[model samples]
Target: MTKQGAGQAGVGQRWTAPQRWTLAAAVLGSGMAFIDGTVVNVALSALQRDFGADVGSAQWVINGYTLMLAALILTGGALGDLYGRRRVFGLGVLIFAAASGLCGLAPTLGTLIAARVLQGIGGALLIPGSLAMIDAVFGDALRGRAVGLWSAATSVVTVLGPVLGGVLIDLGSWRWVFLINLPLALLVLWCLRGVPETRAAGEGARRPDLPGAVLATAGLGALTYGLIQAGERGLGGSSLLIAGLGVAGLAAFVLWEARAPHPMLPLGLFRSAGFAGTNALTFLLYGALGAALFFLPLNLIGVQGYSGTAAGTALLPMSLLLAGLSGVFGSLADRTGPRPLLTVGPILAGVGLAWLGFLGVGRPYLTGVLPGVLVLGLGMAITVAPLTSAVLGSVSADYAGTASGVNNAVSRAAGLLAVALFTLLMLGSFRGSLSAQLAGTSLPLTARAQMLGQSGRLAQVPVPDGLSDAQAAEGRQAVRLAFADGFRQVCLWCGMLAALGGLVGFLSLRGAGRGRQGGGAGENLHEPRGEEIRAGQAAPGRR
Candidate 1:
C-alpha cells in the first residue's frame, strides 16, 4: 500500500470518475450505519409488544448498539489507518450486513440485543473509515465541498431509514427493518472495488493500543449497564459501584493514552481549540438529537394514537430540509469559516426542541409538529457539514481517520449517556404524574397499586380488568397524559444540551477556518510552520 494520498488518481482531482465512485462508496457505506441507528427507534413499540419487554428492556435494544460503537470507534479508526481504509471498510460492511440478518432472525429479545451489539462493532469501523477516505482523497481546496455533499447525501438517506422501517413494521414485520441492510451492504462492497487502499507512513511497524481499547470498552460498557440498571431499579449500591468503576476505567484509559508508545487516539489532537470545541459541540448536540428523537416515535404511537407509518411520515419535513440545505452550508463554511454557523445552528435547534416540549394530545400535526421539525432540521443542516470540515481540517491528512473517529466517539458516547440518563428522568416524571392522575379517579386501592406496579410500561400499561367503561376510559387517558409529561421533560433537557453546544463552539473556536491544519502528528502539537506542513506526508513515524 502507498502512503496516504501519494499520487493517487483521485488525489487533488475535481469530480473525476474515481472521485465520484469513492464518494458514492463512502456515502452508501456510512448511510447503512446511520440508517440502522434511527430505523430501530421506529420499530421499538412493536419490539416491546412482541417480546413482552418493559421500558428498561426496550432501551437495551438501542443502548446495546450504541455502547460498542462509542467504545471501539477510536481503535477502528486507528486500524483503518494502520491496515487499509478500503479493506477495513469493506470488512465492516460485511460484518454489519451479517449482523443485521441475525437481528432479523432473532426469536428472542436477548438474541436481538446481542445482534445489535455486533452491528455496533461493525458501525465503529466503517463510519470513520468512510469519512477518512474522503479527507485523504480530496485536495485541501476541494475537501470542504466534498464533505458537504457527503453530509447532505448521508443525511437524506439517514432519515429515510425511519420511513422505510415504519412501512416494513406496518405492512410486514419489524424483522424486515434489519433485513433491509443486506442489499445496501452488497452495493457498498461492490463500490469498494474501485476505491484505492491507503494507510499511514509506517503501518506495519506501529502497534495498536490494545490495553487502551480494553479499558475504553470496559469503561463505557460498565457506565451504560449501570445507568440502565438505575433506570429500572432506581439508584442502588450495586449500580453506583458499577458506575464508579466505569469512571475509574475511563480515567485509566486517558492515562494510558498519554504514555502509550503508539496511542490509538493521539491526545495531541485535542490541543487545537477548533478540534476540542467541535467535539464538545458534537457531544452535546448529537446527544440531545439522539435521546430526544428516541422518544418521539414512542410518544406518537403509544400516546397520540398514530400508526407506525403515519408517525414516520410526520418527520419527513426534517429530512427534506437537511437534504436540501446541507451542501449549501458546507460550501459556505469553506468561504466564511465555521465559527458563526456552528454557534447559531445549535442554538436554533435548541429553540425548536423547546417548542416541541410543549406539545400535548389532540394537537394537529401541521401546527404542532412541522414547524419545530423544520427549524430543528435547518439547524442541523447548518451544523453537520461545518462540524465535519472543522474536525478534519484541524489535523493533517495522515491522522484523518483518528480525528473523525474521535468526533464520532464523542457523539456516540453522548447519545449513550443521554439515553440512559434521560430514561431515568422520564421514569420519575411518569411515575409522579401517573400517581396524581390516578388519585383523581374512583379506582379501588388494589387496582391502583397494580397500575402503579406496571408504571414501567409507560403508555402501554393496561387498564385494570372488571372496571366500568367510564373508569377504563379514564385509566387509558391517564396513561397517555403521564407518558406525555415524561416526554416533555426529556425534550426540555435535550433543548438545553443543544443550546449549550452552541455556547461551547462560540467560546472555543475563534478564527477557525476550513483550510488551516491546526496540529499534525502528536509530536508536533503546536501549529505547523510552512515547511513542516509541506513535509507532513514524509514524517518518519506514526504519532
Candidate 2:
C-alpha cells in the first residue's frame, strides 16, 4: 500500500477524490459503532423477553460492551498512533462484524453478553481512528470542514438508530439489531481502501500502556458487577467486598498512571481546575443523559403499552433537537466562553428529567412525553459543544487531544456507573410499589409472593395463569404501575445528577476560555466530532 503521512496532501483548497473516500470510510466505520450504542437500547425489551433475563442480566448486555470500550478507548487511540491508523481501523471493523454475528446467534444471555464485550473491544479501536484518519488525510485548511461533514452525516445516522431498530424489532426480531451491523461493517471494510495508511512521525519507540488498560478493565468490571448485584440482592457482604476491591484497583490504576513512562491518562491534565471541573460536570450530566436514554424505551414499551416502533419514534424529537442546536451552542461558546452555557444546559436538562419522573400511564405521547423530551434535548444540545470546548480550553494547546479523550472516557464511565447504581433505586421502588398495588387485588397469596419475588424483572414479570379475567387484568395494571414508579425513581435520580453537574460547571469553570485554533499546539484540535456528541458519546481526543 502507498502510505500517506499527515499534512502531505496538497489539496488543501478543494476536496479531492482521496479526501472524499477517506471521509466516507471514517463516517461509515464510526457510524457503525454509534448505531450499535443506541439501537441496542431500543431492542432491550425484546432481548430480555427472548432470553428470560433479569434486569441485571439485561444491564450486562449494555455494560459489557461499554466496559471494554470506555476502559480501552484511549489505548485504542494509542495503538493507531503507534501502528497504522488504517490497519487498526480495518481490523476493528472485522472484529466488530464477527462479534455482531455472534451476538445475533448466541443462545444464552451469558453468551450474548460475551459477544457484546467483544463488540466493545472492536468499537474502541475503530471509534477513535475514524477522526484520526481525517486529521491525517486532510490538510490544515480542509480538516475542519471535513470533520463538520463527518459529524453532520454521523449525527443523522445516530438520530435514526432507534427508529430503525424499532422497525427491525417490530418487523422481525431483536437479533436483527446485531445482525444489521454485519452489512455495515462490510461496507466500512470496503471503504478502507480509500483511506491511506498513516501513523505518527517518529512513533516507533512509543508503546501502549497495557498494564494500565488491564487494571482499568478489571476495576470497572468489578465495580459494575458489585453495583448491579447490590441493586438486585441488596448490599450483601460479598457485593460490598467486591466493590471495595474495585475501589482499590482503581486507586492502583491512578498510582500507576502517575508514575508510568507512557501513561494512558496523564495525571498532569487535572492540574488545571477547569479541566477537572469540566470533566466532573461531564461525568454527571452525560451520566444522567445516558441513564434516561437507556430506560425510556423500556418504560415506553413495557409500562405504557407502546409498540416498539412508536416507542422508538417517541425519542426522535429529543435527538433532532440535539442535532439541530449543537452548532449554535458551539459558536456561542466561542464568543462568550463555556461557563454559562454549560451550567444552564445541565440544569435545564435536570428539570426535564424531573418532569418526566412525574409521567404516568394512559397519557398521550404529545402531551405526556414530548415536553420533557424537548427540554432534555435542548439542554443536551446546549451542553455538548461547550463541554467539548471547555475540556479543550482547560488544557494547554499541547494537551488538547488528551483532554478531550479523557472527557469522553469520563462521560462513558459515568454512564456505566449510573446504570448500575440507579438500578438499586429502581428495583427498590418497584418492589414497594408492586407490594402496595397487589395488596388491593384479590390474587392468591401464592401469586402475590411470585410477583414480589420477580420484581427485579420489572414490567416483564409474568402474571400467574389460571386467574379470573378481572384478576389477570388487575395483575397487569399493578405490574405497569410498579414499573412506572421504578422508572420514575430513576428519572428523578438522573434529574438530581444533572442539576449537580450544572453546579459543578458553575463553581469550576469560572474563567475557562474557548479552545484556540490554527498552527502549533492547536493543529490537532479539530472540531469535536458532532456525531459522537449527538449520539451521547464524546469525541476521541488524541494527536
lDDT of 2 by residue, 7-35 (tens): 44533456888788889988998888988
Question: For every model in order, what is the number of clashing pairs?
Answer: 0, 0
What TM-scores do the predictions have?
0.86, 0.95
Q: List the residue pairs that clash in candidate 2.
A: none
lDDT of each: 0.77, 0.83
Query: Which pairs clash in the backbone of model 1?
Result: none
Evaluate residue 108 in candidate 2 and report its C-alpha lDDT on the 0 to 100 scale: 95
Query: What are the per-model C-alpha RMSD values against the true structure?
Result: 7.0, 3.9
* Candidate with best TM-score: 2
Those runs of model 1 whose alpha carbons end farther than 4 Å from true positions after fitting are 1-25, 131-153, 187-198, 203-205, 393-401, 511-543
